[model samples]
Target chain A: MSSTTTTRPNGLALFILPSALMFALFFFLPIGLMALMSVLTGNPVVMPKVAFTTRHYARMVGDPYYLEVIWTTIRIGLVTTLVALAIGYPLAHWMARIKSRAGHALLLMAVLAPMLTGIVVRTFAWMTLLSDKGVVNQTLMSLGLISQPLKLMYTETGIVVGLVHIYVPFMVLTLTGVIGRIDERLEQAAENLGASPLRAFLEVTLPLSLPGILAGSLLVFALAISAYVTPILLGGFQIMTLPILIYQQISANFNVGFAAALGIVLLVISLMLVIAYNRALGLVSGQRELQ
Target chain B: MSASIEIAGVSKVYDGGVRAVDAVAMDIRQGEFFSLLGPSGCGKTTTLRMIAGFETPSSGAIRVDGADITHVPAHKRDMGMVFQNYALFPHRTVAENVAFGLRMRGLDKATITAKVKAALAMVELSGLEDRRPAQLSGGQQQRVALARAIVIAPRVLLCDEPLGALDKKLRQQMQFELKQLQKKLGLTLVFVTHDQEEALAMSDRIAVMNGGRVEQVGTPTEIYNQPTTRFVADFIGDTNIFRGERTTTSTVASALDVGKGLILALPPTEGQGTGVLSVALRPEKIRLITRTDAATAAGSSAHGIVENTNFLGGAVLYRVTLESAHRVLVQQPNAGTSRLFVPGDGVTLEWTPADLVVLKD
Candidate 1:
């Protein structure tokens, strides 16, 4: 038994070697190279010189254009998170309340159907629906609600719409796991204690599912901020987010150093927000226990 | 103030054609501690839920204080329920849980605080108000559940196996405490449990159910001593049942001829002709006497040899086989002055005719 126990860790290390090598090669190496490239200065046509300079970082901070793109990205991320939560919560509650197996399966398929198609394909579908003379505009114009077609394309609203559609499923899946864990008897008990159905949900079910809401919000916000395809397709060049600006620096201007600096800034801001969220949750749960 | 409840001809049929509760009808008096005692899947919980307004019956109506509440929504029924698992809100503190119903009723701040304190004090949880349900022991959580239910002064309090989750010792203690609380507060309570002893100890009257139907409803002593059905006799406690044919009947006595030349005397019963009959006798009712002493007993007696002996704490249970090879159980007090019977001892089991209960199959 002692010999086998000593050999178990070595066997585990051997089993993990292949995945560890793959992660280091494909993930960490590129991030390390990017960090190195952010601190060096060189032209694409000349041999690169390794010199430590803070010029890229300075430009990213001092320039108003980069600051505006950063603000826009944060705004879009927050809005998308809010919208997805608003839509996902009721859908998830409906799914969890379904008693029949066939009904649950049908609702589950509907929630997951958007994920099967490519993001690019879904973005194109949104573009067609939001453009001028599209289905929404045609129906609204025929109903005489609007004299002219609304310009939904090439705007922040159009971008948020696309991002919410793409990421709402993640919110629903996370919330479903937590909501399904809540016992139905708790709600029944609340109602039996003079609480109406709606009041029972607001007082008991909502408070118990706060952890799920936090997780789903964090996931949706991170995905929304880092998304590139849907934002670029839906908003075109009118509304530029952080990821779009990073793409522009690398492809159009060939400024890899500046692009890497921007990427680092985005990562740091996301990390700070996550930390703040976790601290707030800790305080709330602590108060809950003491109460 | 508490109110009486009437469940009239109630039945529940699930969607796939399963009758979870048959036509069960019973009236619970005001301030009475009533229990629905049965085994699992015996529809006791379903009947309790229907009274709580959580389930609508398929046929009959439920009346509380002369008002039909059969179709009323659960929230408007003005009742309090304690679940089997003690479904206390984990997110809420004990004080908050106890104050929920009062708050929902639009009670003012001072009134709510006073009532919450009073309720918690009644359950002996005066200092643990701020602790969450997860922080308390199982028995403490049960107290919190009871406090939450009674604070609203509901018309009826429904508890579905509230003490089922505790350890055996704690369960016994809680059973006593619950009975005391119900008596002091004069609250009408409908309790559901499968434990026969708990029901017998706590309830003023018990409705013993089986297969979605009520087998009998009577006081504890009546149900134990004069059970009218075979199911009720076997379900409530241990008994020795003898199946035989009635050979003779008189105004004063009746004789049942069990197989193997053994005859048992029974009291005269109505509608029971000279045909097959079943007699149930409690183990404690039979006395094991020596063969020489059995000859003087005026009642009927059977000669048997002790097959096995089980020493309970205050009593001894003896399994004996008669000369005709029929097994019988006999229980006797283990007093120091009495002689103990061992295996292979020849004895006679004697019982008077009045002790034999004739039961319907």
Candidate 2:
């Protein structure tokens, strides 16, 4: 027994060594390089001596254009999260409550179908639906709802629409697992105590599904803020989110240090938001229990 | 407040032609404790749900306080239900769960608070108001469920196996407590359970169901003492059933040919010109006496040999093999003075003719 117990840890270490090495090589190395780059003063065109400097961080904080881009990214992230939640909650609830297996399978397919297509392809599909002289504008003009085409393809609203469509499936998938675990008998108990069907749903089903709502919101917000491809394709040059600004600093200007600084800032902000979101959820659920 | 319920020819046929309840009918008086007792899939819970308006009967109507409520929705039926699993909301505090029904009725905050307090106090869970349901013990959660249901002051309370989740001691204690509470509040209650002892202990009248049909409905005494069917007789308690054919007819007695030259005398029953008959006798009603003392007994006696003896806590059960090779069971109370028999002991089993009940199948 002693021999086997001593060898067991060795066996575990051997199994974990491969993934540990891969994580260190692919993940930690890049993060360490980015951190070093963020503080170094150098020109990307030539390999020069590195010197310590805070100018890049200061420039990112002091620039009003970068601040505006950060604020716009955050605003778009928040809007996309709220919109996904608003649409995902009812869809997930419907799917969770469906009695027929075929109905549940069909709804599940609909929720996951967009995910099967590449994000770029889906964004282009949205472009056709929202652009001037596109199907939406042509249909609206034919229906006499509007005489002129709306400016929807190159705006923040267009970016939000595309982002919500891409990320709403994440919300639905997370919430389905949570909502499906809620006992239907609790709703019946509520109704038996004089709550109507609608009241029971609002009182019992909604409150019990809060954990899912919190998790899905956090996931959507984090992904939306970091997203780049969909926003750039949909908003064109009219919108400048943080990711777009970072992309411009790297690819257009060859300012790798500034790009690394922007990436670190974005990471910090996402971390802070996630912490605040968790704290807020804990407070709300705690208060609910004490009520 | 309590209301009388009248179920007239109610039946529930599910999709694909499965009959969950078959034309069950019963009248429950105001402020009475009634039970629907049956095994699983016997439609007892289905009958209770129909009255609670969770299930609509496929045919016939239900009337509460002389008003037809067959088409009414469950929330509008003004009934309270306690589920088997105690369906308390885990997200809400005990006070909030108890206050849900009052809040739904649009009561003011102060009134809701006062009533919630009173209801919690009634179930002896007053101080645990702010605790979540998950934090409570099983009995405490059950009390919270009871308080939540009764806080609405519904017309009739429906409970589906309310005490089925508790341990044996807790179940017995809660059964007595629930009965007392129902009496104190003067509430009409419809309870459903499969345990015959639970049904006997709590219900004023019980409807025993089998195979989606009600086999019998009667008071506990009548159900135990004079069951009308073989199912009720066998289901309610232990009994010995003898299958035979009626051979001779007399005014005071009748003879049943039970094979092997053994003709048992039974009381005269209705429809005596029967082809086949089954007589049920309770084990407790049969007495075992020595073959020498059998001459002094004033009843029909049969010679047998004691095959086995089982010593229960309060009684002893003896299995006897009669001369005709038929096994008969007899239970005698451990009165501390009766002679105990063992295997290979020759004995005579005696029972009054009236104790033998003729049953249909």
Model 2 off-target regions past 4 Å? Answer: A1-21, A43-46, A286-291, B249-253, B258-264, B290-308, B320-327, B343-346
| Candidate 2 chain B lowest-lDDT run of ten | B292-301
Candidate 2 accuracy as lDDT: 0.89
- Model 2, A1-291: lDDT tens digits are 787667534656788888999999999999888888899887534865778889999997898988888899999999999999999999999999898788999999999999999999999999999999889999999999999999889999999999999999999999999899999999988888788999899999998888899999999999999999989999997899989988999999989999999998888888898898789789757754443
Which pairs clash in the backbone of model 1? none
lDDT of 1 by residue, B1-361 (tens): 8999998999999888889899999999999999999999999999999998788999999999889999999999999889999899988889999999998999999999999999999999999999899899999999999999999999898999999999999999999999998999898999999999999999999999999999999999988999888999999988888889877534324678788867777764544468988888998999888765435332267788999999997999999998768898999999968778999999988887788888988
CA displacement after TM-score superposition, residue B215 of candidate 2 (Å): 1.6
Error of 1 at A163 (Å): 1.8
lDDT of each: 0.90, 0.89
RMSD of each: 3.4, 3.8
Retained native contacts per candidate, as fractions?
A: 0.72, 0.70
CAPRI band for model 2: acceptable
Interface RMSD of each: 2.9, 3.5
Error of 1 at B220 (Å): 0.6
What DockQ would candidate 2 receive versus the native complex? 0.46
Q: After superposition, how far is residue A277 of candidate 1 from its true place, in Å?
A: 2.7
